[model samples]
Target chain A: MFASIMYKEWLKIRWTYLGGAVLGVFIVFEIFLNLGQIIEFNKANSVWNYIIFQKYLFYSDFQFLPAFIGLIVGIAQYFPEIQDKRLKLHLHLPMRENNLLLSMVAIGTVLLIIIYSFLLIGLSLVTLIYFPYEILVSLLNTVLPWIVAGFVIYFIAAALFIEIRWARRILIGVIAFAFVSMFYYYMGYDSFNKAIPVFTIIALSLSLLILLSGYRFKRGTK
Target chain B: MLVKTSRNILILFVIFVLAIFVPDFYWKIFEKNIRAPFVLYSPVIHDFIISKFDDKTMVRMDNEGNLLTRDEYEELEPLFFYRQIVMTGKMPDSLDGMEIDIQELRRNNFSYRIKPDAIEEPFIQLYPLLESKSGRAKLEMPDEFIRLQNRCEFINCESNEVVEDLSETFSKAFTDIGFKFPAAKIFGNPTTRKPFDEGYFITDSAGDLFHLKRVKNKPYLKKVNRPNGVNVKYIVVTENERREFYAILVSEASKIYLISYNDYEFINTPIEDYDYRVHELMMRGNILYRSFTFSSDDMIRMVVTDREYNKIDQYDEEWISRENTSAGKFSKMVFPFTLSIIDAKEPFINFYFLFSDTRALIGIFISLIIAVILYLRKKIKLKFIWIDYIVILLTGIFGLIAVLLVRYEE
Candidate 1:
């Protein structure tokens, strides 16, 4: 039953997932072009150059792509199910309501991982060509923090959908705006600002707490 | 219905208010503890001193061990105000052998103190002296030009007797152009290498104690001693203002040899329109190793070598000779602002002034654009309300400004 539900979710969002993968590749390619231009024009020599380039590459685009895509895909994933009362149909199924929500979260997570993986692969290839061997190790270290931030955004979106009913759209929009703005303000310009990361970690932690708390089963018919 | 709606609105408003105010409060607390005003003041003074001195100055050290004076030092006395600010706290125990305590003088709750050590006495003394003398006279003096000589000597002495000895030596060096110099700190050993036939050689002024050998009629570096002393074979000094400086070459025969000052002039050899092979040979030899090359037009090209020159299989020709070719160019561009807010807990008023750089402004612009576009798109679709826009814009502006303040500063 879980397999079928997960498969159904996958089938529903396959096109969006594929589009995200392609977008990831395009973004990585653009980043490579910018990095190459910088290298060519400036003639960078030190290993730190590649590390800094990778840091900016992730800072400029990686977080935005996931949150932007996640909000759009996340809202669309649930909008039809909620509006058509198809979620009510799921209540009649032998599986628990928690399973349905978990399945949706699982599917969204899998898709995001796939897209992010594509970006990583593209970045790796470009970095291999342009940078020295030392840069590969630094780039790997640089991307780890972004990867953590991406997961935080993904899970927060999932939790928000479950908690808010009529105002889910509004809440999601607000959350998305707030999240992206906070990321830009804290990580982008103020990367040296130590508080920004602390705040982000706190926000993610709270979101996770709320998600875990919101997991109780609910009976059908208001 | 109205009351319920107002209550919900009030709750949301409160959350929003707390969100903005809480972070500012936290930043204030953080700033109070971390930002050391004294430490910050030190670098500023250091930079000011270095800039006024033209980055590098040739210190004339007489055989009697006194650094010569420069006229420019006296003219720059007024600029030492920043250094005074750095030395404001509890006085460091020593300052050029003068025993002094900087006790804060308080009258009516106002306190201030200036310890003698706070002012680097050597630099302080030299500043006024340099101002009174002509540049020619300053250059000629053997006691005045030693780089950081007075400060180093002053700080090393333990007893008043030692301090007196240092002071007498310094005063004699200061007054006499040629004093049978006192004992000086020898940077490295002056011993010569092998091959007794290689003529009389003296160690270079730069004081690198490495041994050099001629292989296939070319000087190649080989490691002789490790874990004990550095093995510096070929010493090259290239002056930006002049084409020549003295270098000491150590041959395999443990004999010190002096390469004429003119031999170091290969650094200024105009590479423009020159044979590529000549450039390559100059780069390969210890003559021009790790030196920057400049064209007649002032385009700078820095030659970099890996730890083992063997790691570089091929050199990027365009990268090596391109205009404005120094590696620091990119680093400078990317990190435009060296000022960073050391403490995040400072109040917004205190922190805002710190974001006074072009790079921070650019970051704020990018972040705002992203927030506004996201907020507007959601609003148009009736997916989000206007409040979202307000929250995002405020967060974007404040967050960026805050970040710039905390992270961007050196």
Candidate 2:
């Protein structure tokens, strides 16, 4: 049943998932090219000093790509389900309603994890070309929260789309925005190192929220 | 059951967002700005002079509470305002009964400040090892940088490869001095703007301090003797032309010391009560005296000493901090706790939850009553919705908003 549900979701979002992967890799490649150009014009040691002391991020261009991809993939997967009240028909299957809703979100989450992990490896290789493992660690620490935000956005999108009422949807949207923005509140490199665990838990917990919206949709609540 | 748990999670998430933002906006609308006066000790008057903003005007006063004009205030601290006094041709012939030479005053005047944010900031471990004796007219940055991990490895920038010969020489020198591998903390001002390079003051894995510099393309390594019972926390290296000290050492116990050039002696500054994590330390030096001031948001303390580091005079004053203001007290009655992720003391994004005093009981009590009234208005029995009341009792206004927005269904 889970495999069938996963395939159904894949059919709904296959194009979006592939396009997001391409865009993500292209952005990472652009960041790598920009760093090479920056090192070409300036003395490499001076560039390294600026990045070290001034907290300049060479890969800042990749900051918002994950969130953007998550947003699009989420909308692609869930928007059609609500277009003609299609979810009402899908929920009548033999599986439990909660499992059906949670399984849908779990599919999206797994896909995002695969993409985020691949992009992280690509970024690490680029960072190591000119810098050391120490810098790569800080880069990972800094980018971890942003990746979690991508997952949170995806989860919230599912909840928002599946919700039955506009007022509740707007409420959830506002709260989700405020919650997700916390992940990008950067002070410096590796600023979110200590908060990543708590934030990741919160981000994962938001996946359960789709069940409440699904319940409301099932009952046809106002 | 799954639906109920999901609903509760949503409510809790709403409460978390409100706890961080609502009180944050409240303070933004009603916060008071109170600044401490800048205090300085005068060599001529033998007392402290204070300059503060009184409304829209600048007010200058002495420690004895005598008001003075701006020029009179400047004349009192001749050593501090020497440029203005010299331009006005009112420079004193002498101060503290010693003849004052303008050149000596200019050379000896220095000021350095240490803020908690700067001390606790995130920094990359790469450091530039500039040539101390390049014999050039101006200092230039080298083409390589050093990473002191298991060993001191200098990586050439253009090739991104380890310079094996230089690395071997420096690593051997470091190991010969009983220095442990894998440095713990390294501090230095790696810029060509400085007059010279003091290289880096690094702590090894064993927590012992070592000074490493490159002179004539060779390593000059020295193992510094730290004061017994003092563990090093941070060191701010100053490559000043007047190199009386190598760096300012902050001990793990929050005590401040100067790594003096005189046989690497540790000169303790007369700041008996200072926590470098919360208070800011500012040091000013002139030919005759060194002044140390450490202050927080609402309190200021100034200690003046002779050039030989004896505390000759001191001044201390404190006013009501923002948390004690009227608006602050009223906020406690409205918000049970406030949440923030950023701190002025540290450069990190971590939760900083500031809980209110017992006065917050008023807010919680009022929220519970509101929740009960809300349940009654919806024609719901209060006994069935007892968990909603408990949420209100704990989170106060934030929980009230969440419950109202995300009520349980029958």
Candidate 3:
């Protein structure tokens, strides 16, 4: 049952996910090219000097890609379900309503994890060519929170758009906005290490908020 | 029951957003930056020089408030701006019968500043240990960085491999000094472009302070004996050319101590109530005297000490936070309560609730009268209209918006 639901979700978002993957790799490729330029053009020892002495960022342009992909995957997955109350057909299946809802969310989440993991691994490989392990670690740590924030935005946006009541939707939206704002607050690299545990808990809990919207939809509260 | 639970959740969300945003909006529109003067002690004049900035123009005055010209101010503050004075050929030869040399002045001058925001901020764990004594005129970057977690291990930068020999030597150095495995905190400037490197001051799991440096090709570890009953909270490494001190150690008790170079000893500075976590510290030192200034958001304290760190004079300045303006006063009257999640001391956003001032009662009374008049206007029965009263009383304008937007539904 879950496989069928996941396939349905994949059918909805496969193109969007592919586009996101292509864009993510392009950004990482751009960072690799830029680093090559810096290392090649500078004098003998200046590349290391600038990197160590100054706060030089390699893949700053890639910071927004995770959020962009998350947004796209979210809209592609849920926008159809909300049209003409097509979600009711999915809910009426032999599977439990909660299972159906959670399975749909899981599909989106797994897709996001796969997409973002590809980006992170590609970034790690690219950074290894010109930079050291220290920078690779720092850059990975810095980008992790932003990526986590991106996925959380997707989860909350799905939950926000599924609700039937405008009043309650706005209320959920305001709360989710506050939650999503936290991930992008721009603390330096590896600073989020301490908050990551707490944020992960919050992000997982947010995955269940779709249940609230389903309940409202069932109640026909519009 | 589901509707009730969901409505309660909605109410809580509305309240949280209103509390955090309303007060923030007030401050955002009414905010102003208050500029304060920089005061420094002049060993040349044996008095304080006030460098006041009024918008774009800067005017200098003596302790007696007499306006001094640029040259006079530069001469008056030779130690503060000694290089500029000497280059401009305005530096006095002697001060109070003590001859002043530019080179000597350069060696002794040092400055330290700590802002409150940096305390709450998180920094990367990986630190580079630059060679403190490279034998060259200039220091160069090391090929590795040390990560202190389960163990203090140095990894080669290029190959992404651990340097076992160097790591073993440094690990053994720490173990010899009774440093417990896995360092708790490591403080180092980590840049070679500074005058010199002081390496890193590492605190082990048992809270013992040890200095680690690569000196003359081998690791030099010095175990610093912390004062009795004092637990160090933060260590600021001072790599001044004079090498008067290795770092400034702030204790959990809010006491300040200087880790001096002579015999690797701790010299107690006469600074009390020095909370490194909350206050910003500005310290300026010259040939004869040092001025230590610490300020929180609302007040500033400037303490002068001689070469021996004896208290010479202390001055205080207290001012109202710009948020206490007329707009702030009006916000108290207009809102029943404001929720704010952001705070200066927190690294991330979270909930903080502030009940409005007693003047908020006026807002409540006005809202109550309006709700009552509406009930009478519609001629609605008591039972159905009761939730409106509850929402109005609890959330003020925020409740009114929620209740009106959603309408009465049960």
Candidate 4:
């Protein structure tokens, strides 16, 4: 039953996921080219100095890609379920309503993790071309919150879309905006290192919020 | 049961967001910018002169609370405003039985400032080990930079490969001096804009201080014997032309010291109750006196000493900080605690909570009353929604707003 549900969710978002993967690669490639050009135009040592002392981020172009992909994948998966009450039909299957709702969120989260992992690996490879292992580690630390924000947004979309009332949906949306903006407050490299664990836990907890919205939907809440 | 848990989580999340944003918004409307006066010691008058902005005008006064004209203030601080004093032809030939030379004054005049943010901010660990004596007119950055991890490794910036020969030579040199591997903290200027290079001052895993420099493509390592019982916290290397001191050191005990060029002696400056984590320390030097000024949010302390580091005079003053002002007092009465994710002292993003005093209980009590009225108006049973009341009692206005927005059905 879980496999069938996963397949159904995957079918709904397969094109969007593939598109996000391509865009992620394209942005990473652009970063690669820009870094090579920067190194060529200036001395390599000065590039390192600029990145180190001046706090320049070589992969800033990839900052918002995950959030954008998360939003789009979220909308792609959930927007259709609400049109013509398609979720009402899906909930009638021979499974627990909470499991049915959570399975959808679980599939979206796993897909986002896959795409985010691919992008991180690509970024690591590009960073290694000019920098050392330490730079790669800091880069990962710096982007961990951004990746978590992707999950947060995806989970919020699941809740917001399935919610039966406009006022509650807007409330969820405003709160989600407030919560997600915290992840993008960039102070410097690895500024989010200490907060990543807290952010990840909060983001993971948000996934269960969809069950409340699903319960409202099941009860025909106005 | 799962739905109820989810709903409670939603309420807690909203409370968290409100706690951070509500106080921030309140401060945005009522915040005040209070500028501290810039105080300088005068050699001629032998008193501290103060200059500050007051009601869109600059006010100059002496420590004795006597107002002075602009020219009079300039004349009083000839050593500090030498250009203005000399331009006005009021520069004295000699103040303390020595001939005044512009060149000497220019060389002796220096200002060094260290803030809590600069001390705690994040930066890449990699540093360029410039050649101290490249014999070139202009200093050039070295082809490689050093990373002091488990061992000293120098990787060429262009090739991104470790120079095994140079790495081993420096690694062996580090071992020869009984320096441990894996440095805990490395401090250096790391710029070619300075007059010279003083390499890096590294603290080993055992907290021993070691100075490493590259002169003529070789390693010069020195294990500094810090004063016993002094644990070094931060070092600001000054590669100045005066050569009087190598760097300024702040110890873990909040004591400040100068690493004098004379046999690497630790000259302790007479500064009392200085916590480097919260204060801004500014050191100014002239030919006759060295002034150490450190200030926190509401107080400023200036200690003037002779060239021998003897205490000459001191100035201390306090003003009401923003949090202590009338608006601040009202805010305390209204907010149980203020939450912030960014702090000026640390680079990491984490929750910084400032819990208000007993006055906040007034706000919490009012918030509890509002929540009770709200629940009664909505016809919600108190027994089924007891947690909401507890949250309101604890978090005050933030919890009231959260529970209201995320209404629970009984």
Candidate 5:
């Protein structure tokens, strides 16, 4: 039952992962435009320039596109269930509600990681044209923050949808986006600096709690 | 059902409080950054034009105390046209009798007869005037000539004559009232000569009263001790050979009085119409003759000063006399360093510090908003998701700790 639910969640998120890949291609194309400028200036040969270009590609507009796709995927995972009132059907199933929630979150998290992996690959291909093995390693280290950011947004979207039961999810999501945007505007990027760690711990704790809730539901059914 | 509702309400309340108060708490912990008063830039006005091209002819005063023409003053302009005027200088011990005579001649357009016997040892002593014992000591001089010398190291003697005369008059009045220099022991240091304490007894040839107190220390002299009315202090006196004019830099130490170049009645007749244009012109044309006055309580009252013109048609008359309190105390307490990294062009690491702190706040707000939306949508279907709560708790705690670590590191 858990496998089936997980498969269903994966089906919901597969397009989002594809969309992220497409977005990654566009980012690489944009990065090439800048690289052309560097090549003209004869500054693209060095590993540092390559690293800088990679950093810009990952951190610039490309970073948000992936996160945005992840958010939509996260929202789409439950929106259909809420719309059809099919969430109540899960209660009738022998499988625990906590198990169902865990499967959904796990699937959502895995989808984001896959999306981020594709983005990393895209960055690697573009960076490989100029960067060496060591610089690629450094660039890989920088990608950790973006990946963490993706997971964070996924978990937050899950939590928000689980907490609020109406179409207001989109509204709440937009408001959340606006609030975060304002903070980013004032504070700058690297919101992951403090936020990523917090999100990690929260996701872990929430996963455990969902499992326990499922266990309780199973016991009640028995 | 009520119990569940209450529990949810309690959870929401806790989240709300954390969301609102956490940022402020974090801000309070790192209040040092917000309160730190860093200097954006130092007031260093380098180049300036003096007058219109037509009237731009430089004037100078010859040795015979006459305003020489532009042709005569051509050779003298370089002597007075300083590439750099060093405001910071060590106080000279004393001025010679000849120097005093020269200063007097430059200031008054008439030379004073200096008797060798009349010359007295010039010293500074601190005198406490207020009952609170918070009075500043003044440096005294025999006459206005000595006073100008004591104020500025013979920089602008002519413009300082008015201030010197005022100090001489006041010092004589104070001395006649049996106001002796407070004992050296009162300052707690006997060997070190406090420049403010030395008062010159200004007496006529027969030692008659010319009530005046010459203040050698520019900072102390710039402070107005009067409860009411304006007090002028001599900043510098320089003899300009190019202009053939003796320029004296003076500033009012009074906070209450506004320094204006409005036409004052000369002998009950309006000397000139109240023209801001001319006042602005005079203020601008005279670059070396600027006044910066502040209140007795250290509030900057005004800075009515001139700046050099960079263009021929441009009249850059910068009279920035702001009545604002000095942020000295706040800056000292919050930002200890005179040269802060915040003013640097690159500020690479500092930028990271500010960015990280701001990002932390953003993260918290974003997480909260997302959580609220999820809670409202019932998408978070984990019935009793203690793990999510614990995760949130841990994240908040860790974020807070990280913020604290950065602040303490600073």
Candidate 6:
């Protein structure tokens, strides 16, 4: 049954994962290419010094790309279920309705993880070419919240896109925005040191939201 | 099983959302701007002068509370606003019986802020030792950065590999100076914008202070002796142009010591009773008076020291925090609790709820009345909904809104 549900989700989201993967890899390549140009044009030591002391970011544009892909993939995966009231048919399936919806979310989450993993490994390899472990590790830590946000937005946007009622949808939208905005709040160098645990819990817990939203949708509460 | 779990998840999500969003919304709409008072030492009156924020006007007064014109205020804090005073052609020829050197005054004038957030932020334990005496016109950044774990390793940037010779050289120099390996803390001003690079102030694993600099591509390591019982907590590297001090070493007890260039000596600054966790230290200096202002959200404590590090005078001021304001007061009648995300002292966001004080009882009473009215208007049964009552008792109007917005899953 889980494999069947996973196959259905795969049918719904294959194009999305493909496009998101292409876009994600393109961004990773661009970030590395930009860093290469910086290393080529400037004194490498001065650039590293500025980054260490002044908190210079050579790949800031990459920060929002992960979350953007998450949102696009989420909408692509879930909007089809709501169209023509298809989720009602989903509720009547032999499997438990909650497990079906949650399975869909799990598949999307796993896909996002796989796609983001490609970028993370690519980024780590590119960073190691010039910088030492201390900086490469710090840079990875700095971007961890953003990647975490990508996974989180997938779950939250799934919940948002599948919610039955407009009023609840708006309320959930506002709440989700406030929740996600916290990831980008402190832009200071290494500012997410202590808050990483809090953010991780919040991001991972986004899966549970599908249960609540699915419950509402199953009841057809408008 | 999923419905049962969904109920708990819904409750958790509701609490998280309400606790983060409600207080933020309240503060956004009601927060008032606070203009804090600034204190400076007046070389003319030889007393501390204060410029106070009085609603709409800037009121200048001495410690005695007599109001004066803007001219008197600027004249009093001449050293602080010396350029303006000099432009006004009302310069004092001599202060404290010594002729003021404008050039010398300009050279030493600098300010710094030491906050708990900055000190508490995590750092990469590696440091680059830029050669101080480069023989060039300006400072040059080093080709490698050193990390001292079990031993010091200078990893070159280009090859992304360790320079074993240079690392061993410094590692031997560090061990020769009796530095315990695996340094506890390291502080350095790594920017070339500073007047000169002073390298780094490292606290060894044994909590001893050591001054490490690279001069002409060789390690100049010195073990600094601390005053007995003055344990170092954090070191702030100040590469100011004047070169009076290399760094300011903060002791565990909040005592500050100036790490002077004079043979790596540490002179204790007169400022005292500062806490590394609470108070933010703001230091401003000129040719005459060195002013230290220790501040928290609740109070401002200013101390002035003469050139010899003698405490000349001290003044303290405080105002009611925003949490006790009229808006905060009114919020107690609306929300049984408010949530705060930012720590103000730390650079992070977390869910923290501040329950309203005694006045929130009014909010609870009003909420119950409204809930009863809603039950009557909707013709719903009067049987108790435990969730509604629980939310109202904890969050008052915010809970009421949550209940109304998220209607019963009948």
Which lDDT values do the candidates have, in the order given?
0.36, 0.90, 0.75, 0.90, 0.36, 0.79
Ten contiguous residues minimizing lDDT sum, candidate 6 chain B? B3-12
lDDT of 2 at A2: 90
Off by over 4 Å in 1: A42-59, A164-221, B1-410
Tens-place lDDT digits, model 2, residues B1-410: 88888999999999999999998899899886787899998888898999988866789999988999999999999889999999999998988788989998998899989999887687878788999999997888898889888898998877788999999999999999999989989989989998788999999999999999999999999999988988999899988789899998999999889999987889987778888988999989998899989999889999999987889999999988878899889988999999998889887899999999899999999998888777788889866678888888899999999999997876
**Chain B, per-candidate TM-score:** 0.22, 0.97, 0.87, 0.97, 0.21, 0.89
On residues A3-118, what C-alpha lDDT tens digit does candidate 6 reach at each position? 88888888888887898888878988888889889878987777777677667866676799789989988988889988987888888889887778878888888888888888
True contacts kept of each: 0.00, 0.81, 0.15, 0.76, 0.00, 0.55
Which one is best on DockQ? 4
- Between candidates 5 and 6, the one scoring higher on TM-score is 6
Query: Roughly what TM-score does model 3 have, to 2 decimal places?
Result: 0.82
Q: Is candidate 1 or candidate 4 better by lDDT?
A: 4
Per-residue lDDT of model 5, residues B3-50, tens digit only: 233233223323432443443354455443211110110112222212
TM-scores, in order shown?
A: 0.37, 0.97, 0.82, 0.98, 0.37, 0.92
What range of 10 consecutive residues in model 3 chain A has the weakest lDDT sum?
A43-52
**Number of the top candidate by TM-score?**
4
TM-score of chain A of each: 0.70, 0.98, 0.93, 0.98, 0.69, 0.95
Per-residue C-alpha lDDT of model 3 across residues B382-407, encoded as one tens digit per residue: 79768778878877777766555445
In candidate 1, what are the lDDT values of residues A1-222, reduced to their tens digit? 888888777777777767766777778878878766766565333222223322344325554666556655656565555554566676568975555666666777677777777777777787766643334544543454455456556665555544434443354445444534444432222232334454445444433322231331122233
Model 5, TM vs. native:
0.37
Two-chain DockQ for each candidate model: 0.01, 0.79, 0.26, 0.81, 0.01, 0.58
Interface RMSD of each: 17.2, 1.1, 4.8, 0.9, 24.8, 2.3
Q: Give the runs in model 2 whose Cα sits over 4 Å from its true position.
A: B382-384
